[model samples]
Target chain A: MNLVDKQLVKNKMGMRLIRNKLIKQLFLMATLFAIIILGTLLYRIFTQGIGYLDWEFFLSFASRFPEEAGIKAAIIGSLWLMAITAPISLILGVGTAIFLEEYASKNKWTRFIQMNISNLAGVPSIVFGLLGLTVFVRLLEMGRSIIAGGLTMSLLILPIIVVASQEAIRSVPNDQYEASFAMGATKWQTIRRVVLPAAIPGILTGGILALSRAIGETAPLLMIGALTFIAYLPENIWSGFTVMPIQIFNWTSRPQEEFHYVAAAGIIVLLVMLLIMNSIAVFIRNKFSKRY
Target chain B: MLTVERNRPMASSISPIKDNSIYTVRNFNLWYGADHALNDICMDIPTNKVTAIIGPSGCGKSTYIKALNRMVELVPSVKMTGSIDYNGQNIFNPKFKVEELRTSVGMVFQKPNPFPKSIYENVVYGPKIHGIKKKQILDEVVEKSLKGAALWDEVKDRLHENAFGLSGGQQQRLCIARCLAIEPDVILMDEPTSALDPISTLKVEELVQSLKKEYSIVIVTHNMQQAARISDNTAFFLNGEVIEYNKTDQIFSNPTDKRTEDYITGRFG
Candidate 1:
């Protein structure tokens, strides 16, 4: 090649390398932007709330005085909410997933149902609150009870669980199904014995993540009329409840600056609960993934 | 039984005929949606012998074996027309239960697919599904089935270990043991040793030879020498049709059809 042509190629190659580096730096910045925001939020919450995370802060109930406010009632209320939401969502969700994957024929009608389910997962959480208000609260006359709020939360997470469970069930290898069926196992027997066990770890991971979302949800419970000032634990499914998010939301709205710190403390508690639930999910997935 | 004796006929014939036939497939044609996967096929699989189906890829050898136990029906779009009579009962007869048919006809796949459970549990899966609840009975079944598959000694001490822990060859044998636990009369193997090492392949071939003493065995293989080595009868398939069927020695030594001779000679697949 001539010297001029060689020089031109070198210039082009240098430009291309610079362009690649520029795009890589741009993507790196985009990722770091999200991490920076999350880091700042975590830093702010931990610093502002660490002082308020004493035993006394956990023992007392919501008070007009931020110094006396606590999350005892909210903690119990969130637990109660999960007690109802987890089983209802899991049973209904996994059942629906199994039916859609295993039993339902791949026809126009099933496709229609499948499309609607995917659409439901994207529907806003507040819209589900409105749904719960209509169906569980006013229509059922359950009155601001834990069951009413829990059922609403279940409805909110049902689509998420169902979609995740469907993916899990679908991921089971066809060989497993064939082997089970070739052994004279009936459809139900194959599903119950082989499919369900193989799909459980996935189902549990998804179901737990969905349940954690329900625990952190505020707008739905608020719309369902969960009290912001409950001082005692819910006595039954019919009893009034106040979850951590609603309590934290209430404190954030207060005029006193001290209340903001209390809200940060509530956020810390909620984050810890979510972390523990997620850890359990990871544990179950790792344990079962190794087996199969 | 609803006998449809007027089904269209196919051309291939089995020679050196035996009196006791486990499966008599007559004009069996299968279609996956609009695509005809298996054309009219006819063969009499002799009882108490290893019958091998040899074919190139996508020639419907695997499909033919799957059809014996009605496992092909699992595919949503599959449609079949014709009859496969098993022990004098038409398998496709509406009155004949598929579960009962499967309980009598077991299958081992090309890949070793033991369940992600204990070795003992894998062998007992079929029996448990068949409603054998007693632990003592299950223990005996596990031992007998493993022994029958020639896997008893290798896995005896580690019966409680996960089946996945076994070697690939052992896993395949465990699957055979699992099938034997159901005590099926006929065992269908779809390229059972195709995924194994040469040593493992020879072991499985020997197992098949031993297994045929009691259970009727029908195997599909891509390896021509393996067919000659282990099978009593061999059927050559091409383009979804059975080109020739005869005694293994006759087919290998003196193929009747020109195409069969070419396939056997490795001139063309």
Candidate 2:
């Protein structure tokens, strides 16, 4: 090879190797950055919260003193809220999904509705709180009760559940529907027996995700005036309630160092609850997937 | 068993009732939106016989068979004219319920699509929907239908297992068994063996032949040899029209139409 050609080849090889190394290192650094930040946060939370995460922390009611405070009332309130939110959101969300996916005609109106739902999912959760404040709290006279808070949370997560459910329902194979129809099944019969069963795993997955969001949501519930200092469990749907995230938010806002530890402890509890819900969702999905 | 006799004269001259014609289609035409899918066609499908519709891809054979059971209407903007008479009743008539008509005219698709359910549930799905609730009756129906599809011996022990556990051929046979559970008067097969291996295709072809003894079967197949092997009568469709339809022997051996001859000889699609 000529001297110029040899030098040119050398330069090309060197550049290629250097570029590859640079790109790989850049990606690795990006991933490590995320892991380091997350690791630090987790380490801090565990260290600060471990001492406060005992049975007393769970059994005692919320109090002015950080050492005496517990999440007993908040835990019950969160459970009550979920008991209302889960069924309402699941039924309404799945119903909307079925109507849109199976019944609604694919036309301008459906596209318009679909576009609006996607947009609703992106809108700030606090906006839903305002809407719920007006509709449920003032107009409906629900008045900051657990029912009002649950309804607000449902509205907040409704779009996510609907979109998730629609995706799930749409993923069911067209062949299954055709097979069911070929067997003398009506539209309703096919949907009930084949389409819904096949889509249930996806629906449950979406529902669990939405419920997790509902559990962690404090802004909407706070906007709806859920009390942060309730000492007793809710007596009925009409009774006011406070959830874990709100209680933690209340603790972290206090002008005391010890309350921050209590906040970290409350965060750990919320995380565990979310983990349990997610595990149930995964179990259900796997069981149903194996069946088909 | 029906004899596989070749060179038998066409039964066109006999009255449909005497000849046991289960379906008498006349001047049937179909359009999906502006595109014509099936042209004006007239044919007679005899009861207790296998009639195969042979065509290349998109030649409208599947559309014609779907029209027989009123399934063609499921597509959006589908328009049909003329009549398909099933047992002397026009299936498209306003008084005829599509669901009731479908109950007597079961269909199997190109893909073996068993519901994501247990084998027992898949088989008993049809009868159960029509209100056969007793477990004893459902068990009997499941066994008889599986036997009818030649799948009972293989699947009897695993009836409660998920239907997806079966192999491709077994799944197809399971679908056939599911169809049989309803005890329909006719079974429509839409290229039912196209998705299977050679051995599985042979198994399905044999099952189709055996099923003809009990139910009138209308099959659409791209495989010409499959049509010849399983059908008593064959219809050659090209470009949304039936060029010639006759006894299977004549259609394959001495097709009157030049187009049918060219197609059968594989000169062109």
Candidate 3:
């Protein structure tokens, strides 16, 4: 080959290498940027909140005095809300997914319902809170109880669970169904024995994600008139409740300097709860997820 | 000395087949929306015999076998106008319970489709659904079924392990054992060995041969030699029609039709 041709080839190779390196560096820079922001937030939260994160902070009730404030009521309320939301949403979501995926014939009406559900997932959380206020709180006369709040949160996250569950159910191979049916298994039997077991990991992963979102949600609960300063744990589903986010919101909004530290501590508690739940999700997914 | 029937109505052969037949398909025509998938199919599948249906791809061989178990109904747009008599009952009749019909007619697929569960669970799945709740009975059924499929020795120790952990051949055998556990009178295999290695294919063929003594076996296959090796009766399907159906020896040795001869000789599909 001529020197000019060789030089051109060399230039092209050099350009390609440069381009590859540039793209790799760009992606790496983006990742580093995300990590830096996350690290900064975590560092700030820990440094600001570490002092306030102790037994008294967890055990004491919300009080006018910042030092005397605690998240006992908030923690219990969040757990109660979750205890209601998780089962209701999971049952309704998984049932809807099964009905849509297995029983319902593919038609225009089903497609319309599916499309609306996906749309519902993207709707602002505040809108669901308003909906809860109108329907559960007023129309239904649920009166801003834990049940009302839980039901509202369930509605907000139901779409996400349904979508995730549909994906999980849909991912189950048709061969499994066919094999089961060929063995004279009824539709319910096949779903119970084959489809549900195969889809459990995915279903659980979805449920965890939905519940996590529900736990972090403050807007809907606020709109539904949850108290910012509950001193006692709710006795039942019908009793009033206030979750961690609202308590944190209450603390952060106060003018006192100590309340900011308390808010940061509450944030830490919420993050840990989310971490625990997500870890369980990951465990279930890894433990049970199958190739086919 | 071999009687080869060509384009004959199924009713004429019913008298001879009725005594020994497990499935009598008469004028079985199926349509997937506008496309004719199985056209005027008529065949007598005998009891305790391996009947292999051989055809080119998309020639309705698989469709026909699936029809035997009424699995074709799973397709939404599929329509059929025919009578499939299984044990003196018209399966196409709305009055007939499909689940009951399927209980007597089990199926294995082209690929090894174990239920993403342990081998023990896969085997006991059918019996459990059928209300066989006693643990002792299930254990007995699992052992008997696995042994019957000639897979007990290989999988006996690892019965609790996920079935996907097993080799492809073992998975296929597990599927067979699963079918056997249900104690179905007939087993429809839609190219059961097509996805396996040569060794696995041979193992499945041998199992099919042995399985015939207790269960009526209907298989759809692209592999002609597999049919020759295992099936007692063979049917050559072409363009949604059965071109020839006869004893395996006669069909392979002296196929009456020109198309059947061409197909077996690899002249053209």
Candidate 4:
């Protein structure tokens, strides 16, 4: 038979073929859209911000105006924030996740709490700002203080931290629990020694992702009353504080073009910090997943 | 063709473990959600004997064994109306803690589920939970249980290694050692070697035969040959009912129930 004449060709659409084409087209579209958006963002950031970087930018402290400024106070503010937010959020978020996963019996109340958490995750960051302002700042009367800002940020992202932590803890296989029980270990012992170690990497990844989000948040801080400009370093919880985002906002809002360049410098520093946080999260995830 | 194979004490004319003594079950019924899982199970387990429950799939043999220590309570939808007597007391009594009861009657699953921990930690995990914090005592218990399971020599050199690193046979032996360390009254095994190769199956079978010297054992297995080889007493369950109970030799050679004989001879499942 000849190659062209002896073969059959399909002219009708099969359901499977239509579905396959849809899936392939969808995947290609998503990938291309993601790459394009990411490229644009990186290009805009690097072009405006890259040339503004210098040795003095890293060394000198912030000024009331961008005419005499660096990110020293802002960087220190971020470092201090990490010191407070990381441990406090970790304890509360991981504890709540474990409680929901392990000890909460099947009931409507537990379901209600779970629904509230997911809804809180969906709630806008600025809404949390209003919440923190009303509850933590004005209601508590801890006004314009660094601790108030940090604690307010903690409240803002607490749902994300808890939700991600719950997912991490739940990913552990049920066999591990059964194995520990069969070996006559108590419930607390099993959780403390076996389940926690197995879930550590996942928990750390969730935590770092959440903390990165907290680092980028300025709307909540603004609502909770953060000082945009500060000359002196904060030594106590009640001292006035200014973070990198507030510093960037202060510089960018000025009438001078030089101030616009300084805002670019602050954005660059923030990008590098967020990058390091993401890298640490990926590293921890890989390390523990291998052991498990 | 069957020979009586039981350890008889010379001074005792009757087996004290029998004659309405030891763990007694009376008119037990269990349900999983709306499905009746076990029905009307009436039997007594001896103090120091291996009781093998053999049956087809969905026959409630596994359900009956879990009823011994109320391990069935863990399943959220499980409900039971039965009195399981352990040492002349109803195991379902209000004061009995489920944790304590489970500790006293340890269980091994069908698959070898070793902890993601060192071999030494797997053995010592039990004692540590029971408030035995003295390092010296925990050391003794780990060594003794590992030696009893016949795994000490092979795993002794690398006691600190993760248990998942071991072979399947070694891991199953490690699980048995884990159960043995708590000093339980009865050890319940649910198809302990169903997930292993023939070699690991044989090793676990041999270990079960020797284990009866210290602990009462109840095993649920689908393999007829394994029941014939390792158990002292045999039970046959079919469709959530006890079809027959007899000595092991009688079960393999001459079962009273036609269903049991048919199952043993491989005529039908």
Candidate 3 residue spans exceeding 4 A from truth = A1-10, B1-19
Task: Return the interface RMSD of the candidates, in order shown, one decimal each.
Answer: 1.2, 1.6, 0.7, 2.1
Lowest lDDT block of 10, candidate 3 chain B? B7-16
The better candidate by TM-score, 1 or 2, is 1
Decide which is better by TM-score, 1 or 4.
Answer: 1
Q: Each prediction's DockQ?
A: 0.68, 0.58, 0.83, 0.50
Per-candidate Cα lDDT values, in order, are: 0.91, 0.90, 0.91, 0.82
Please tell me how candidate 3 rates in CAPRI terms: high
For model 3, residues B1-40, the per-residue Cα lDDT tens digits are 1334442433232222344787778888999999999888
- Residue-level lDDT tens digits of model 3 in A1-292: 5557877787799889999999999999999999999999999999999999999998999999988999999999999999999999999999999999999999999999999999999999999999999999999999989999999999999999999999999999999899899989999999998899889999999999899999999999999999888788899999999999999999999999999999999999999999999999999999889786
| Candidate 1, residue A287: lDDT | 85
Q: State the TM-score of candidate 3 restricted to chain B.
A: 0.93
How do these models rank on lDDT, best leading? 3, 1, 2, 4
Q: Classify candidate 1 by CAPRI docking class.
A: medium
- Tens-digit per-residue lDDT, B93-147, candidate 4: 8997777877888888888878888999888888888888898998899899999
Q: For residues B48-74, could you state the per-residue lDDT of candidate 2 as single tens digits?
A: 989899988899999999998888877
Docking class of 2: medium
Which candidate number would show the highest DockQ if scored against the true structure?
Answer: 3
Query: Which CAPRI tier for candidate 4?
Result: medium
Q: Write the per-residue lDDT of candidate 4 for residues A17-78, one digit (tens) a residue.
A: 89999999999999999999988987777777677688777766777556468887888887
